[model samples]
Target: MQFYLDGYRPGDPEYRPAAPGRDESSKGAAALPDEVDVLIVGTGPAGVVLAAQLAEFPGITTRVVERRGGPLEIGQADGVACRTVEMFNAFGLAEKLVREGYWVNEATFWGPDGTRNGSTAGITRTGRVQDVADGLSEYPHVIVNQARMQEYLLEKMRTSPSRLVPEYGVEATGVEVLDDGGDYPVKVTLQREGGDTAVVRAKYVVGCDGARSAVRKSLGIELRGDARNHAWGVMDVLAVTDFPDIRLKSVVQSPAGGNLLIIPREGGYLVRFYVDLGDLDPADRDARKRFTFDSIVAAAQKALHPYTLEVKSTAWWSVYEVGQRIADRFDDVLDAERGTRTPRVFIAGDACHTHSAKAGQGMNVSMQDGFNLGWKLAAVLEGRSPESLLDTYAEERRVIAQELIDFDLRFSTMMAAHPTDPAHPELGGVDPAEKQRMFTEAGRYTAGFATEYTPGLLTRSAEHQAVATGFPVGQRFYSAPVIRLADAKPLGLGHVAQADGRWRIYAFAGAGDPTSPDSGIAQLAAFLGESEDSPVRRFTPDGADLDAVFDVRAVLQQDHRELEVEALPAFLRPVKGPFGLKDYEKVFTPDLKGGRDIFDERGIDRERGAIVVVRPDQYVAAVLPLDAHAELADFFAAFMQPAAALV
Candidate 1:
């Protein structure tokens, strides 16, 4: 939210000033570039997010091409996780999305009343629980159309300095990785509607074209998993229902009929239902053809039992068989043990993983995949980091994709299973109460907050976990209320982060006054600001803003009113922008007005203090002591390149 440094624009400050020769007017008027730093395939959640992130860096030449004629209008995935909302906030789109989307606060469960003649009776309310656990995230689990989500991201890209716009009606037909070391090492072949083809060279390629990705086929990667043989009919409809929990997310289990999952859409009148269509016969290839929209409605009517549903109109409906699959690898390097080779091609979203959508993780996880890889790609292409930094994309995201598939398999199985049958002892059945418990427990995972990257080049070991217990080294940086020392404005500490391809170093003050020259924070700030080997001094380009490559900020233990902003170290209040304006929003204190002490809430050691380093994507990369200046420099040295070297 820092602004007015570039002589004050009248419009929104979030809209960055357009780069030279790059603006909304240039979109589509300029011919396609023969070469680009990155070429992304598909306009889905993954590709759009990646393109949006790259748009922030005008120096990076990025292009996104899609097979579709235009933007997605309707009929696709919804159900946005809380973590995804946090990412949207980083891109400055969360506010609009939350205002438009439906918040899922509670969920109710329904099951048959009692066993009758080896079957269940009429359905009855079983249990009700909170949809997302308290304190999991500041953002709520939202239900919005995937098309709308992409529209917001695309808008961000269009308004960015690069004015990035996807080239529609042109699709990637093939990909080939080159052996010789050149600026553009990957070749991509694209085809238009009229059968005209063109070839483009790129430094890197990302395939987000979905389950039947042609780029993935070019790489010869196989999606390895099994189909559950169960089929479910999903539909978005405007309907009148006697079911009390129609607005609330509900799971209905009927032994005599089949299972049903009801989710209310963003609009108050629209709702979506995943009606169980029973097990699919392996031998029958045309089983899905036999079930139509009318059959889906009939199945929903039966599943509700005594309750009734009068459908007014159907917005979108489809039949899908339950299946869980993940690609063998996400990058171009096939054999890891052979030799050191940087990845030039990658796959994300449904292009790399496929699973049942019952867990509401498809779109959420897919967007995260793009977020995880976007910054790394930008850094490498800008010469801020080495090409080896690209390897971590596959290493980290592949594990998360596998975990999603495993969880989805278990969750979809429970939702599809029938209630217990007393007469049929041989056939195992799902207990209604147990199913409810599982749903409540899986909230963290489904909300996208449970992902933790393993220790690697990007993440540090938990040896310093005692420094900042709340900000785990390998997980997303958790936010807490903080008051701006300069303006007394209250906001989340994590809200300061923007997807601008810069690292974050949060220096929490110890018990001693941070203004004192002898305090731990003062000494640490001096080292980071003045030392020759400090990451800030070495990685930042000559004459650039002091916080250009690394955004260093401080959090004090005392109230903002008690502290003097002028007395803080220069690094904590660095001069930036073309006008050399002193950035005042960098310093923060505990949110006294909100009655929350960040140190106490996040388990920060007030006596010792801590430094939490967060990546561009908002994941905590390292947690260290306030005076661990050497460790801080060493951590960044592993990945970041010295600015002088690029010159």
Candidate 2:
């Protein structure tokens, strides 16, 4: 028998773990694989997160390419919404962000010409901005640079079981969809740093290559939208200032200078400023040059007339033109064959949509765009879902992109307008309340919590509306605390709905006897536990790990003490992990004695509870009466092959 470390040769007796992120290729690292399950272009936040997600699936292999040498240093798109934070927590990435970022809970507003000479009078007012995401999740908005965000995601990918590495200094020149119908359908041509080109094949290709996407262009997808003709100068600065709201998330409207959106960064002293660079002709090269670092800082100082402004140092800066555009389609196939659409090519993040970064949504929404597509691709490639499942990526994400564009058009128009500016007549005479309402209303959309998919496969039920709680179908399931019956551990329902690629079936088994013939839990246990041709058995691949395909959990209304592992149904008991470790958290109940009531919060009835199905992406797929096992089977059958058929 022989044992060796990753970097050691056969003769080496000692073993040492390879250094993190070392370019092992220079030290005998293997060359890139000839084929992969997924080929991701552009190592931006979206591409990296997508790769990280695909890593969760044991059989899915991913190869990512970046035109740049490495991660970006700075360019202000740094606000992580509360909903995005909750997603990070589900993936165990929230703590890292919390430690490296600052939270913005309240926003301050300075208006009606507060600036006098270079300093402002005492801060006029502060508004509770955090309320926008209140009740949506326990997490709050975080501010971290896009670069750091990518680094964190990349670190996670490197440590993942897949150990995927993003190939830098490599550009994807072209992609062609093949009609051969073999497993790999997309052929991509890669241009290395030395001007050498190589071709690789992949089952699917995802373009996260930003606004100027080569893949999207190659697909002939037209991005539709009108240019807003609005341009803004953004800069990050560490400074000394008398401006009271300098440290807060603020909208400052100067009487003479212009409008400025201020965002405080992670380190206490660092601040980002978004300055309205009044309408310059698109052909005006001289005016464009004026949109520089020194010029932007001067504009900021003028905006805060009486507030003493001093730029100690600048971390980064840029001038971006505001516009609203979305690609016509997110996923597409180059050639039509045999009446079937091969959605072998897809685009996400900035490749699909682009808008002002003022809302802190660019990176958040981009990463989520990848998140949505990642699992769907993984499931289809692994044979857990049909090819048609990929169609929903375009259907669901295009709607979101359109909505985001619409929201940004309205919000940006308002932000770019000064009360005295005649160019934006709509916002010229708007009052403070109306302005605040606009911010808050748009905040809801920007938070990313309001995103809801139309009912489709998985989300085939409309019964959620009739439930006591207003939990809607085709939406991400909200969180409510419940106690694990076995160990009495308090856990948030949303936290348990991790983004691991698996369907989660939560059976709300209302209080009843363990063996009662009419009890929903008893009936469920009976139906799901059958060894031959069971409902669950018909939903996954043959001989596949059942727990990996479906995460079955029970929310019982009974007292915790009355239900033991041995007393419950076979399917409702603790499942053994890979190492034979027992996972007792699968069954939960409201801690009535502790005054926590999840059933009430989720609108689930204790008398006749519901069975809720959540997709791998954590979207609520279906909600039905507990005994509707047939409907659940149908939901799976819509996209999956039966186990017996697989044999």
The best candidate in terms of TM-score: 1
Q: Tens-digit lDDT track for model 2 on 415-443?
A: 87664433455555554456677887776
| Candidate 1 Cα deviation (angstroms), residue 181 | 6.4
Q: Compose the digit string of candidate 1's lDDT tens values, residues 281-340.
A: 989988977899999999999889778889999889999999999999998898753247
Steric clash pairs (candidate 2): 117-305, 118-305, 118-306, 118-307, 119-306, 119-307
Best candidate according to lDDT: 1
Clashes of each: 0, 6
All candidates: CA RMSD in angstroms? Answer: 1.7, 5.1
C-alpha lDDT of candidate 1 relative to the true structure: 0.90
lDDT of 2 at 26: 30
Error of 2 at 358 (Å): 0.9
